[model samples]
Target: MTSEPTHAEASQTGTLRGSIGVAGIVFLVIAAAAPLTAIGGALPVMIATGNGAGAPMAYIVAGVVLLVFSVGYAAMSRHMVDTGAFYSYVHKGLGRSMGLGAAALALLTYTAIQAAVYGLAASTLRDLVVEYGGPDIDWWAWALGLIAIVAVLGYRSIDLGAKVLAVLLVLEVGIILALSVAVFARGGAAGIDVVSFTPASFFSGSPGIALMFAIASFIGFEATAIYGEEARNPKRTVPIATYVAVIVIGVVYAVSSWAVVLAYGSADVAAAATADTAGLTFGAAALFMGDTASDIMLIMLVTSLFASLLAFHNAISRYVFALARQGVGPRSLARTHTRHGSPHRGSLFQTLSAVIVVGAFAIAGSDPVLELFTWMSGLATVSILVLMILTGVAIVAFFARSDVDKRWWHTRIAPVLGCIGLIVITGLVVDNFALLVGGSSVLATLLLVLVVLVFIAGVLISKLSAGKEVDRSEHEESRT
Candidate 1:
């Protein structure tokens, strides 16, 4: 038998360099969640159109479900360390065809979400510029410019991107937490309503939609495992990072959202949100803190979106690299930069794809926030939930046949419970798909159909690609 490749050899070729610690990985994962963007953007929408005052409860419920999912997910990370993450886990348990399908869905999930964020980020930036007396410009121009900057950052060493994200994450999260504290300290609008957590309120006004949006906010937390290969001592680092990131995201979102409800009082919050969905969070900041605090939050919102774009860019590029390395994509995409040790080819590919998608939306004169962000983000939310369910099942299957670390909680119980919860959430998403995508049933149906077709196409590609299984086996062995 031939000798295994050295660390240096692997780094110079197929394997990503290990440079990040647990904190770095956590930064990347949490930054992708974009606390400010989720609170200031998605939270108001959830309050207005979802479960209203009970919106905070929805976030708590979503967090608990994902925490259970992460138990088994972290266990799996101890055994396998690869950038493929969900694709590799599903492949190990469900077989190559299902693995490829999961991979394709993941690609769609990340790509579409990134594009969605770009739409919002571009629009937000355009508005900010005009508010500050800058020259008027199209949203697409701002989007393209942001994409170019992300491309440069993504094309560099992974640590550089992590550092940038760490700073942005700290600032946005700090402002949000500060705002939440101020609201509570001032006794809020109605003395901190605990009724928001009541079952009656929680189940009111379409809880399914509320849950869907809450869960969507947690999308980027699973990305912890995606950075495993680049993490120092991944077996330890990945698991710790995963748990920490999940808890932090869940807490930040839940507390901040609850604070927003307190700022407006539980009774009138929904109406206020409906009246001014875009400005609801800003208004809360202005009321609880000061006008200066609100202005700072507006600036932080842009940075939060920028940080999210960079995080997702890194994630999508790595997925492309992983697939290419597995012989499921172009081999060139597998190549890393010799100097930067980053997935340069994959980064360039993702950049171009974003440009093309955004260009098409612009040329068609689609509304960035309404059409591009809503539809694409809605599609991503559903697709990712489905992937999570599949991954939970795959974890159970993989552990059933293997003797490695046979803890029942980590290997079976948690995964099964998480799977069941995910199934329910997925069903909810499907039931409210039209509402999630701006009340367009036709568009919702088409998007759902597209998800199914993309998965089927992936399965077909796996069968058609010669030597794919062999390539996957060798790749896994090398990493192990």
Candidate 2:
């Protein structure tokens, strides 16, 4: 019985051997998260609600900060080879206990974000459907249908899902870029001004609120390491993916936000955000393209959100499978598919997590989007940031003592700076968690405590099992 798993595991590893190339990894970085890009939705809204024209600058601040964090993260990936992502990175950098804690955070954060995306997808689907005079399909129903689709895709080879995501991600970036460029070409509201993104705009939010959302929007960029096991060449591929993803996501945010700010003129930003439906980007769209053009953008926004949800579904599932493979979750979750070579056992639970999240929101008498945006998404951001900080720590530690070959830049100083940057950003965001969810810190504290507790327990268990392996290895050398 055990022999079969050992062979299947070997085979699973072998199947994705050379398949996912640099382009595939890049697609993974850009997936689902593109729609949630800070410039397109949050920043423009932030301009009116708090930041002013400086909202675009807020993204610049966040981007530079994250790029700093990536210095260490990518450096660590050069040495630590594991699909376990943060869990493994932290373990090698810190220890089993710390790694476990990171793992727990990974599970909660990934699953929460995955469920959160469902709520977003549902709301967008609901509105889009209603626009055509279709019956009001309940949000949960739409969420479940999407969850099912994600479950299926996640059950097969990762490349299958990657292909679909590449197409969707391309379309998402293309559509948003087209609209932003259209705004730029149409001109007039402010006539193509670069001053709108000046450094001073970073302070427009209530102290740190703009930074919180800015960092949150960049949450998925670090997921490049999550594909190490399936990537074509783990050592080289992961680092390139990590860097490319960060730059791409950052550039897109900067350009897109500047386009919006330019179209509307920074002066009218706050006024537009506070008005009736109050998210200024749409107003900017209408300002340049008329009501019909803005409406089309809204429709495209809806599609972008859906693609984002599906993208996240795949991410969270792999995270689940990673934890399970390490004996953190049920043993069955450690199993892999013989034919498709995906985390089939884990895929079953992907939608199952959505079911529970939906049921929880339904029981709480809250809207899914509210739950998604407020609770799950915020927690996910916190968790991933924590992982980034931990990854930086790991990179430093691994380079400090690892017998493996490494460079001084990849291992030492860069990672140290990355650690410092991530810790700072983490502190900033965690400090402003209440704002991210648009709720009281009191409630946010309780939620954070609950989530952290789960992460801690995962850490404890993993530490104890560090030297133990329930599934005996077929290869005597043993693998990461």
Candidate 3:
């Protein structure tokens, strides 16, 4: 077991506290709501149409790259346990400056994904509400309802969050798995098409475009660190959870995506996505749901989207709370509830931030996915890659500087390999940014640009805040 940060105050202490056990930890790591969010299914559909048999291979490739990155990430987490998100990991390993930039990026990346999903949820639900109730209500209103539910859950203990995630995880993974088996049971694609899981498929696309989608699929996994402050045992729990989450999710994606390729026939999968890539394709849903039942799947997806938004909102807030507690963001954001012991202030801020963003987009009439995932996802991926690379390097630097002796392979070899892989993958994703957000409405681009600008602005604000702290300290001494 590794030591958590002195600042965390050990929420469940001494009595075998972390209590989350392996079960809770696994659920948190899987983040079940994400796979069900339409992004996973859509990516597979796009791959089949755009690249032929190569799409599932892309997922395999992405999973491998991420698995390599997790080696160093989990290693670092074992030593440093702060809910500060990536910023904290980099800060302790790197410095205050790197931490600030990382924090800024995390905020933008997560918030954008959450809000974008809201737009998706709203649009899909609006259609559902009209069809089911024959009444047209504002989608934003429904989105507001989701925000409230997330706020309520966030107010509860972290363990409750884990429970909720566990239940959702089963649903998301179960449904996807069911579809995969159903497709395979019928010998749907005519053959197994085992070749779809190779590197050849990954490089077939412009590879750059496929990489961007691949990176987006992995974003939710990073939230594992946010649970650091709450984990039953940060050292053992964090490292294992980080690796397990990536590996498990990656495999599920590879298997499920390959299953889709087999079912649809590589030729058909690509075509479906190319036609309307971001929109949910209901061939399987329609198959299971019937013409009238198609509405049921749509409704379930909308629910999943809403849940994803809330989950992210919870993550972003915890990140802000982490920074605040360290005196980086507004000091008030750091406050935790005296009783629930939750990051009450941070949760409130996250919900409010999301509400403001959703309202802004609704007013501007923006395209949610294009705006949410494209630009925002791009920036987030960039930031996370930067953090992952820095964290990997930080592990090396800390061990070298501290003279903390450990196995060279655990400390050196793995991280070095991981860093190189991440650096390359991140560059590829960012370079092909346009491919990801292609033809998204102008408003979509502008809003994402604005989101990036906000992150940049955060860096400046962090610096100013640090300066004020120094000045205030000096003034107190002068008075003495």
Candidate 4:
């Protein structure tokens, strides 16, 4: 029998001294999902412009599709543990070329999502502060300050980020659940309408768009695998966190949205949402719980967005570290901190990128909510869907060739189905791309082209680097 691998061999590419368990991983993923922000910010827009009362069903549907995706995802995690999760998986299953492409795509998607939240967070904070009689500061100023804070947290140990996210997640979930309970006690205007669950309503107008938005809320759940290197018994921790995060996000979103619909009459939710797009959740809470509840929710929304920004920041840093370790990017980024055991180099780079992107928008005098937040979020949504589709394909390819576990469903059936589902969703997003960004068709097409170009660039860079390495090896052999 082979002896156990050395510590260095076991950790092929060094990571932090990770002791994170399932709970810490769950908190990170769920914090990225940002339940309070989704319910308070995105849900109202979905209800008003999407399938109205059917929005809750969209969350459930998206959750089910992702659960199928997770079956193979978890199965693969048992053998492969890399911080660049999507990239590494694809590299092992497909090829190095495709793996590098996935790395670029993952990096882009995470950065874009994090930037989107900064825009929203800064704008929300600006309004909240101004309303409370504080001096008016530009949204970008607030964004910059928050970015500095996130950079600091992300430059430390993973456990510190986990702990901070845990507190924020609890507060966000607590506020929303309290509102749901209040709604239950008071009974909504329609008094427990079952129509929200009816197929006719669920599949009504604009359901595809509703589904797209629903999928965005689950973005962080896929990231559970990204933390595999930091997890205790990653084989178990990753899968359990993946399933738990998805179910919690889906149920909380579904139940809270349904309660909101019930709080207002199902027939009137769309109109009510349209009238007070940003205030829908707060208004509902105030209706049942009192004015104080709405006030608390407003505060929680700001903190929720902050938690999400921090989560995404950590994810991007790890992806950068993973790629650098694999020789797919700048060599310096692979270095981890001696004291903190964190990828501080990557964290610093990511922070710098955030400042540049946010600063560009600030200098242009654009609307933080409409232009910065909306455009970045739209880009992230499309890019992430593409990554998920590629990952699903990678899972199928990886399992079909390897027989580590040899389970039929995990190896063959589930991954194929998940890929099909993602393919359909990708098509839907493409059809409604303009709606997603509130932009013209030309702009949407350009953004899509940019994503393609990024993937191609990564492939070309990887091929060239491999060629150079081969030449150097041959030269050394000739000298010998």
Candidate 5:
């Protein structure tokens, strides 16, 4: 009789293979953040509806908070290096139940964000096609087409995805930086006022709302650890990529938002944004670099969205792979392609999930940006903030129990501070949830409740699955 394969043997067969370095991991993380999409899309709305000229300061504030969070996060990565990332780290620190809970939340967070991007990407692509005299296709058709493309890329080698993201990220950042340089070189509309950075300006209008959006833009920075298994010298590369991704995203967002404020003049930016929320960034680009540049920026915007979709697709698939490997999800999802070494099963599942969600939205005749994008993105923002707070707590807990690396600042103080900051941000997200979703309070409440329900379900599932055998020996081997 043939012997049953042990979990260890099965895990070894499904292991991901790669040598992704710091830059490649950074490319994946930053691409998910989608700088151009944030600037052209989120920033204008933040200015008009949130903090006005003080929006740049909001990005700076959010960055500092996350930077503090990363201190403890980096320390934890050194010891618990796994592609499970937030899930694995939370599990290491908090125990099996909470880890499972975090894993579920992580899945929800990435999936929602990916679906949200699909909505926006579809809408943006539709508009671009019609503007250039292409067929006026439905947004869902474009979304399904993009999903198919992302599924293909994600099903290949991790390095291929990283390479594609690198090129797209460079182009996205290049155009945004060029536009910023032109604005600053011209000394802005009224000579580059410094008032936007003031404490008073930072508190102007709805600062909480502004901070929420700012924090949302930094969503993918923490994903550095998700590529740890594929990364070369992961103990060092993961931490370095984490810090670099955070700083790069922060500086780019703060500088670009500041430049936009300068382009319209501090006193007038709010009015300009309010008048033309969708066109605010494009208008500035046109004013500084000509209409041709603006058109290019439009094209880049669509690519930026595509890059984000691919990045998030990779992330969610890995999450599924990690969970399945640990016996928490379907065992089939843990399998990798023999040739590509990619989590092809997990990728297929994510692709199908996107299809169902996007298809439902289309059948409902929902507005892509207003309903699908706004609601799902808002849901993701809150879910991620909650996960960060949990991760911060878990980091402190893990260090407390283990004598691994007991630097007071890294293990205790920083994690505590990060948790506090994240908690405050979570409160902001809760209070302004309605505005964030662009919907009624009832809808916001329902969405927030959905996050809570998912966590509880994960915890319950963990309890029920306690008897399932999980081979963590492979993860331990990686650490060794």
Candidate 6:
């Protein structure tokens, strides 16, 4: 008779295979953040609705917080290795139960963010087509088409994702850089101004809101560890990529937002942003490099959204694979492609979820940007902030008893401080949740409850499943 496969043997079926270097991982993380999307889509909102001229300063401060978080995070990555990432680290530091809970939270967060981008991409693509005198296609039609494309790519080799992201990221960042350089070269409506970097400007408007947007832009920086299994020399590559991504994203965001302030006088930026909330960046591009540049920026904006969608799709698929491998989800989900070594099953599941979400919103006749993008993305930001705080605490817990590396600062001091900072940020997110989701306190509360319940459900299912297996083994022993 054939022997049944052990759990450990069975779990090896869908292992990821890649030798992605730091540059490759960085490309994926930065592409997920989508520099152009942040600049053209989120920056003007930050300027008009958040901290006005002080928005750039908020990016600097947010960057500092993440860099500090990286200190403990990088250290943890060295010792604890798993693609489950946040969940795996939490398991090593905390307990398996808490780790499973974290896995559920991570899945929720990534799924929501991916769906949010689909909504944004669909709407943006629809407008882009209509602007050029194409037929008025429904946003859902575009969203469905893009989902099919992403599904195909995400089910392939990890290197394919990296290569595609690298190309899209370069073009998007290049266009934004060109626009920023033009803004600085032409001087301001007034003269060149450094007011955006000043303390007074930093405190001038709703800095809390600005900080929220700035932190949101750093969404994928923590995902370096999610690809740990695929990364070549993961310990070194993960840390380097994490640090580089944070600093690069921070500098680019601050510089670009500052240049926007300079293009319009610092004193007048809020008014300008308000007047043309949707077209402010394009208007600046038109003024500096002519209508042709503005057109190019608009087209790149669509591609930028597509790049982000693909990046997040891959992230969510990996999370699913990690969970299924550990028996937290369907066993079939853990199986990888024989030739490509891709988590094809998980990719399909994630695509199906996206379809359901996008379809539901479309059927309800909700405004894609307002209802789908803002609400879902805002919920994801809040969920991720909670995970960050938990992971920081887990790092401290992990090191308090062990003496493996023996670096007090990395294990203790930095982790403690990072946890505190993230805690404060979480509180801010909670307090401003209504504002983040466009003043729907009820919806914000519902999302928070949903996240909590999902976590609890995961923990209970794991515990119950373990208990059942133990009981069955005991019964067999009694029979023998």
> Per-residue lDDT for 409-445 in model 1, tens only?
9999999999999999999999999998999899999
Considering TM-score, which of the candidate structures 3 and 6 is the better prediction for this target?
A: 6
Clashes of each: 0, 5, 5, 0, 0, 0
2 or 6: which has the higher TM-score?
6
Model 4 worst lDDT window (10 residues): 8-17
Candidate 2 TM-score, C-alpha based? 0.90
Residues 1-480 of candidate 3 have per-residue lDDT tens digits of 988655545432211112465566667656633676534445644464346567666667778877877776777787777776577767777677666776777777787677767766777777777877767877777778777888898776777777787777777777778767776777765666676766676566666656556666777777677777677777788788878888887888777777766665665666765654544335544553345544545556765665566567667877878877777757777767655667777889988888898888768776655554345555555666666776778777766666554767767888788888888887775565545565445644564566557656767877888899999999999999
Candidate 2 lDDT tens digits, 307-405: 666666666767777777666778677666887767777778877877898768867777876666568888888888777777777777777887574
What is the lDDT, from 0 to 100, of the residue 234 in candidate 3?
78
Please estimate how well model 5 matches the true structure, expressed as its whole-model Cα lDDT: 0.93
Cα error, candidate 2, residue 131 (Å) = 2.0
Whole-structure CA lDDT of model 3: 0.68
The alpha-carbon deviation from the true structure for residue 456 of candidate 1, after best TM-score superposition, in angstroms, is 0.5
lDDT of each: 0.92, 0.72, 0.68, 0.88, 0.93, 0.87
Give the TM-score of each candidate. Answer: 0.95, 0.90, 0.87, 0.96, 0.95, 0.96
Please provide, for model 6 over 1-480, each residue's C-alpha lDDT reduced to its tens digit, 9 standing for 90 to 100.
Answer: 999997755655766888899999889989999888888988898899888988889889888898888899999899866788888888788887788878878888888898899999999999989988998999999999999999999999889989998999999999888988998888857878889889999887787888888888888776799888889999899989888988999999999878878788888989999999998888888888899999999999988988888888988899899988987778889888776778889999999999999999999998889999998999899878877887888999988988877898888988888888878777767877888888988998998888788789767877887898899999999999
For candidate 1, list the clashing residue pairs, or say none. Answer: none
**Which residue ranges in model 1 land beyond 4 Å of their true spot?**
1-12, 466-480
> Clashing residue pairs in candidate 5, if any?
none
lDDT of 5 by residue, 1-480 (tens): 999997655654457888889999999999999999999999998999988999999999999999999999999999977779988988998999999999999999998999999999999999999999999999999999999999999999899999999999999999999999999999999997788899999899999999999999999876799988888999999889989999999999999999999999999999999999999999999999999999999999999999999999999999999999998778988988776778889999999999999999999999999999999999999999989998999999999999999799999999999999999999998999999998589999999999999999899899878744344555667789
The parts of candidate 6 lying over 4 Å away from their true place are 1-14
**Residue runs of model 4 more than 4 Å from their true location after superposition:** 1-13
Question: How does candidate 2 score on lDDT?
Answer: 0.72
lDDT of 5 at 354: 92
